[model samples]
Target: MPGTQLTVTLSGGDVADARAVVRALEGSFGAPDELPGDENATVRTATFSAAAEGASGRPAPAPSGGGQEGGRLSAPVTVTVQGTPEAVARAG
Candidate 1:
């Protein structure tokens, strides 16, 4: 059976947000090919990783009102999607 793989890299402090986007894509498309039943559907797996110093650069400045300083953070997320050619096309 034919399948498709999709990877999306993200940099930020929030993981939920990244997940949300992936979920949205899956919902809009379908489940991954590896998953059962979702064979012809779109399935996604997200891998999160921190970015290097030179990549993200310094963290954002501290907020006003004497709040704790915010550190620079980066997250790289890879979303692998698989599905049939028809499914992949539909998802695309």
Candidate 2:
């Protein structure tokens, strides 16, 4: 079956909050398919990283020019959830 990717972005400073949210999601949805059991959904992968320059609306500055700081504190995470259509719909 097809899967869904849930991406959540938060301020880089809020790492704790981000982790908490991930834990909560895990508790609610159970683990992703790769984990082990069939009862819990599988999580293909969970990644956390700082937003790169120009990733957001703000663009990076030219070589000799000055611009707003491109490297702002931002956290971007991607979680992959896999399950049947009924399960997915219910989870949604």
Candidate 3:
């Protein structure tokens, strides 16, 4: 059976911060499969497979209780990482 996938989005902060954001995620997910058009875009996005821990050794903090619905955010410096329950949890 196929595994799962995760869509992680990080926005807000200076547009230049996009690089840093992607860098942070690299620890969890390998280099972004895709990236925003503008390198300095405030809103950056990345996608990762379930077994995408070939980037960094750091693991993202696990999420608290409650379900995490995949959706957009209306805030600055917002990070939305969504995927299968397991993938999401792992990415968290």
Candidate 4:
């Protein structure tokens, strides 16, 4: 099936946090094709491949249980979503 590709930017974010975000969004989009690395760069990126919608018009699976605790700074973060209109809408 033709799917959608999504690119998300995690600016001034940590890998664990980014992973958490990915986990949280797994329901909308399947596991990311590219997950953030362990590097704590000022900016990072993650690529995800999604099916737009799940079976029987239902949403995808929820994220797994696991995360870290820590405060973060409100830095500039950007998100780039690209895919079919329907897929994009579903991801959004």
Best by TM-score: 4
The per-model lDDT (C-alpha) reads 0.35, 0.34, 0.56, 0.61
Question: What is the Cα-based lDDT of residue 91 in candidate 1?
Answer: 38
Query: What is candidate 1's lDDT per residue for 48-89, written digit by digit as tens?
Result: 112211233322222233211242224444444444454345
Once superposed on the true structure, which residue ranges of model 2 sit more than 4 Å away at CA? 29-92
**TM-score per candidate, in order?**
0.32, 0.28, 0.54, 0.63
lDDT of 3 by residue, 2-36 (tens): 35677877777554454455555555555556654
Worst 10 residues of 4 by lDDT: 67-76
Clashing pairs in 3: 12-77, 27-56, 60-92, 61-92
Candidate of highest lDDT: 4
Question: How well does model 2 score by local distance difference test?
Answer: 0.34
* Residue-level lDDT for 37 in candidate 2: 20
Superposed on all Cα atoms, model 4 deviates from the true structure by an RMSD in Å of: 3.7
Clashes of 4: 0
Error of 1 at 39 (Å): 30
> TM-score of the candidate numbered 3?
0.54
Q: Which order, best to worst by lDDT?
A: 4, 3, 1, 2
Clashing pairs in 2: 31-41, 32-41, 32-42, 32-43, 33-41, 33-42, 33-43
Task: Report the Cα lDDT for candidate 1.
Answer: 0.35
Candidate 2 lDDT over 1-92, as tens digits, reads 12333333323234433344444444334332222222233222332122212345232232331212443324443434444454335334
Residue 69's lDDT within candidate 1 is: 27
